[model samples]
Target: MSYQFEELFADIQKDNRKVLDDIEPFEHPLVVLLRKCLEEQEYMLDRLIEEFEEGKTELKDIKTNCSALFHANQKVNPYFAEWKRATGWIGYKDDTPSEELMKSLEERLDEMQDDLIEIAAKLDEEYGESTTKYFIPTFYLPEERVN
Candidate 1:
């Protein structure tokens, strides 16, 4: 979310051309863009995971009945549904959060999904379905890309 498409792409083009070009010689720019976006999401999720592990937030009280978790989960559910439709990716057990803090993190991830889905749509439109078949790691592709 902190990164912008044009700026990030330009940074990649300016800095990592050799590395990217070497690995994905014929890769479309959109594919490179999507990869970076997913990487950003990965970093965000890693932070959340670290926090959860460190007990930085009190997330164990599930029976307290907070609507925040429900609303956040609701917001994130549809994003995963769309992601499954778009990529045939399923990440249920690995991605679901255990408590309230996770639910909020899921909402944040849902917001980040917009950039990813937009780039994917553009990739599909410009280069066809073949180019849309890029890999999204399980970490970032939580049960719903944030569960």
Candidate 2:
């Protein structure tokens, strides 16, 4: 997760601007994918919060998990806000985008995972080692499960 700040800044400055004086930002194809990704992520977060609430978990535990999820998801918040602005003009569309589009979206999402790792590492390096866990927990794959 060796993050090059220049690379990310360049991505942000890509040619995705509003055509009209007060329009949205869907010029970048990645925005389409990001909108859907945000929805799915929010849905999952809702489910997790509901599960914890149903278990009669302590308030602190619920807050901790929910806050963690929100903070991690907010890493992509800027893109989500951009898509929402676009939707305000064009409403909700796209039940199914092209196969090629979907593939591109998947690739972008993979890149996002790398970005998350890099961000975590950067925070740890600048602040303290404990900062990484504060941002994101150590994840385990299905094969790595103790059970």
Candidate 3:
């Protein structure tokens, strides 16, 4: 069965909740800042959904934008791996994304990552807590090679 974008989004949210629960207490300012960043991501996803349903944007367009966002995340800094993981939920049953769509998605993701990095850096500077270290790397090599 093919999952709709909304369904995929729901899954991402569920995973995000799990991550939040695992973190708990959120004593660190960096953790608080990361939560805020997640909130912004939720807002952006909601906007994408609204735009798609309203016909302001097509599904392909949305997919393209999402792909760009992921690509950008990889390029700017690998620290925001969780964000990249969230985007992976956006996939189709066919398991094949158009090149054009992929390019657009990469671009959008890159831009979003920049915004997130800036937020993280500013939060660290202002709040005096560096939480960037907590971000788990989203990409991994084969177990045989690393371990």
lDDT of 1 by residue, 11-95 (tens): 3233233322322432334344533544443344444334334443332321121122223223344543443343333333324
Query: What would the TM-scores of all predictions be?
Result: 0.26, 0.37, 0.36
Best by TM-score: 2
Per-model CA lDDT versus the true structure: 0.35, 0.42, 0.42
lDDT of candidate 2? Answer: 0.42
lDDT of 2 by residue, 1-147 (tens): 212432432232221111111122334554645544454454544544355445543434433543354454554546644544554466455542344543444455455455445544443454455433453445411223213
Candidate 2: worst-modelled 10 consecutive residues by lDDT: 13-22
Looking at model 1, the pairs that clash are none
Off by over 4 Å in 1: 1-4, 7-100, 134-147
Backbone clashes, each candidate: 0, 0, 13
- Please tell me which model should have the higher TM-score, number 1 or number 3: 3
Ranking by TM-score: 2, 3, 1
Q: How close is candidate 2 to the true structure, as a TM-score?
A: 0.37
Weakest 10 consecutive residues of candidate 1 by summed lDDT: 61-70
